[model samples]
Target: MFSSDIKIHIHGTSFTIHTPSGKINISLPFLGYQNISNVLAATALSFSLKIPLKKIKNGLLATPILSGRLELIELKPHKILINDTYNSNVSSMISAIQVLDKMPGYKILVSGDMSELGKKSVLYHKIIGNTVNLYKIDEILTIGQISYEISKISNNGKHFLDHRQLNKYLKKIFFNKNKITILIKGSRNTRMEKVVEYLIKESKKHVNFVV
Candidate 1:
């Protein structure tokens, strides 16, 4: 069971997880509606396995952050990089965009074509475009063939044929001393991490990146 009232904050999310014995407040380090779904699934599994509430709480808090999965990387000065480049699909892409909508500062979305989408690739990309158009994203940069469709529909979107050109453009953006939050995501084959690497290298701040 779960409580109806759930509160979200910049620090974390607070929700009630009800079990056979009682209910406990669970807090997660990450944001987004998808993460809440994940927590619910985990809670159901833990209840089925008869795990103690205390252990469940501890495990939830101790969950190791994954690479390229909504990982927050703080750059020098005042900029944030959201690295969710592990992989992408229609569902995940929409979720990422929704998360960006809630974030403060100038929000920029850097996305690549989603792979393994089969025959519906164009359709899915179009859907993503429409979703982005509906959001408050300040800028959108897309890569790959299908992703071009996203840029076509966005108000301030640009499509890059390859990473090199995108990197060149990003170099200029990073030089600006504005507080910006960038969300980078794409399919696994897109190697979106390279873009993040370039940004860090350009910073020249000697900061260690998690990816």
Candidate 2:
């Protein structure tokens, strides 16, 4: 049986996993509450498999960073990117916004349309916009047709009909800013990874590149 006294504590970019054996300190190379929840689920699964506590700790510590899935990229002079381009749903988007609210610095959210939501797409998108408005995010950039719904409810949001326009605008904005955290997310069909790639490439040439 798993330990009944398990406790989890999140402090900034790191979190502590307390188990019966010992405590494991983990620093995720990603952002968002979903990523932390994924780590917790993995820890529980390892315990159920009878993996040694030490090995579990080491494994979690050594977990490789994944691309376009809550991946964290840092640029010199204090610019951070949260790339969660793997996919999106109403639930995940809300969780991402909540994570952004807790983070320090100037928070910017770049969101693309969430596909596969079918008949509920409009309603869900508006819901996301309303939730984002309640967060501490400084700016919201939305792309695609359905995503415009998010901008409607946001206090400081701009909607772009195409990726080209969005990319151009972002380049100008990112180049002039420092000490900012940007969260990028969308569905697979939305090809949101392009936004992440654009920012990374631009950062190298314009900003003091870090990682």
Top-scoring candidate (lDDT): 2
lDDT digits (tens) for residues 1-211 of candidate 2:
3346666788887888887777888776656766677778888888778788779878887888877767778865567888989999988888788877876678899999999998999999999988898889999999998999998789999999899999988777666676788899999999999999988888777644333
Please give the distance, in angstroms, between residue 25's alpha carbon in candidate 1 and its true position after superposition.
10
The C-alpha stretches of model 2 lying farther than 4 A from their native spots are 44-53, 207-211
The candidate 1 region of ten consecutive residues with least summed lDDT is 3-12
Candidate 1, 66-105: lDDT as tens digits? 8888877777655878899999999889989988887768
Per-model clash counts, in order, read: 0, 0
lDDT, residue 181, model 2: 85
Q: TM-score for each prediction?
A: 0.77, 0.86
Candidate 2 residue pairs in backbone clash: none
> Considering summed lDDT, which 10 consecutive residues are worst modelled in model 2?
202-211
lDDT of model 2 at residue 117?
Answer: 90
